[model samples]
Target: MSEMQSTRRGRPGYDQQGILAVAVAAFNEHGYDATSIGMLAERLGLSKSAIYHHFGSKDQILDLALDAALSGLEAVVDDPLPASAVEASAVARLEHVLRGAVHVLIAQLPAVTLLLRVRGNTEVERRALTRRRAFDRRITALVSEAQAEGALRADMDASVVARLTFGMINSIVEWYRPGGREGADRLADDVVAIALDGLRRR
Candidate 1:
């Protein structure tokens, strides 16, 4: 099967990973409902049958793309912040994770955009949203911990803080384009400053 899929239209042969990236970009640009298999084939410079040969349906591509997108956030959620950078402080850890989330959004711009835009209309979309909410819960716990430690303000509810913080980071998909005047690290720095400054205890 691999040998048979060596080349299609002088481009690729069953390159699901590469095809997934293109599909994600198209989905992000035109919306998942608007992007068609025919459009995907044209974007990938392959035939519709070639795309169908690898993916049974367009939803499969969406599933894979959502997988690609959510994995980055999940990886960040699962990671243990190094003691050197965070100094075992819940607030520091929260800041570190928030900053990292921006970098992930920048790095996986297209897929993350799709992840943010999911409407839960399908099983795949619902599953992706569930994973996102799970990540949100994790951040909320961190916010709660930070407040308990007197690191963050407790005037507002922790869940509200978490929601607003993520609201800012998630909104990046709407206006962020690659090759911007600022790098991801710089954007992370600026975003962290703005997010943490407002949340920090006076």
Candidate 2:
């Protein structure tokens, strides 16, 4: 059968992406450990078999959902500065990463929220936590570099700065509604302003 026909045969109109989206929302609502295939199937209005048609197990779904959040963050960290920003200061590069992180968190709010809630109970959660630590290290390194360059304060620990900075950013998931008075750009601007204002050396 053709791809379209195969999709219909497998799960009617629901594809992996749609299924994953619903699954992630449920994961966020009920906790990953509490969410089961049966619950997901009920949420999707499909049978367990139909849910399995897209994903092999609920763990696989959790893996994918965590990846959705981690990949966006990894991309923000890995992406090189624009050509025009090649000569930018360490603080400037740090600011860019912060803005990118806010954008990612806003765009992938559900996945990010789920990621933040993981406690390494499963292999997938452990792996995500490892990647998250690596991301945090990169931020700390950047903060250190900025401090070394006399851009940010020298007295404060870089790791502390990184944690506190991300503490602010990660907290966005709690109250950041998409279509609220504050748009992503405005939020990014405000985050950068608030964060960098405190970090920037006098």
Candidate 3:
């Protein structure tokens, strides 16, 4: 359906996307398991049936929100490097992926935050976790290649490095505030620097 028609069909000024955003926020605030369709309806000032009109169920909303995050991260991992970076070393490509991840995290903060909190309780959460592990494997391979090329430290296990790097990136959701002291670009740069280059002086 056209955007106009979809908007008119739903509550005024609220369509599926708007409703999904509010639902994500609610899920993040109260644990997803604790949240319900009734709560989302109340938060949106609409009846439960109105919510059902847009979504099949609360699980459907969770599925969409998780996909928002997973797709962003998957894109970062799957996308080919730019022409300049295509010939770059594995470490450089790794850095590029890391920067991209930081941007995705910042841009899709709510979805990504919701994703990180998932514990594989339901089929939706399990599917997200599975995709997340695949993403991690890609990063681990890149880290291994970089180490083989003598760019990154060899002492650490590649999978461990990958997890730790993402651990730092994932931690941003707890503290990052959009339009605050730092912007996404700066945060990306800082994340790459700290993850690649050690905090101790060279």
Q: Identify the candidate with maximal TM-score.
A: 3
Between candidates 2 and 3, name the one with more favorable lDDT: 3
**Model 1: number of backbone collisions:** 0
Predictions in order: lDDT:
0.85, 0.89, 0.92
Cand. 1 Cα-lDDT = 0.85
Q: Give the TM-score of candidate 2.
A: 0.92
Candidate order (lDDT): 3, 2, 1
lDDT of 1 by residue, 91-180 (tens): 988877888899899998888888888999989899899988888999999999999999898998999999998999889888888887
Q: Clash totals for all models, in order? A: 0, 0, 0
List candidate 3 segments past 4 Å from native.
Answer: 1-11
Taking the tens digit of each residue's C-alpha lDDT, what string does model 2 give over 71-148? 999999888899988888989889999999999999999999999998999898999999999999999999999999
lDDT of 3 by residue, 119-144 (tens): 99999999999999999999999999
lDDT of 2 at 76: 92
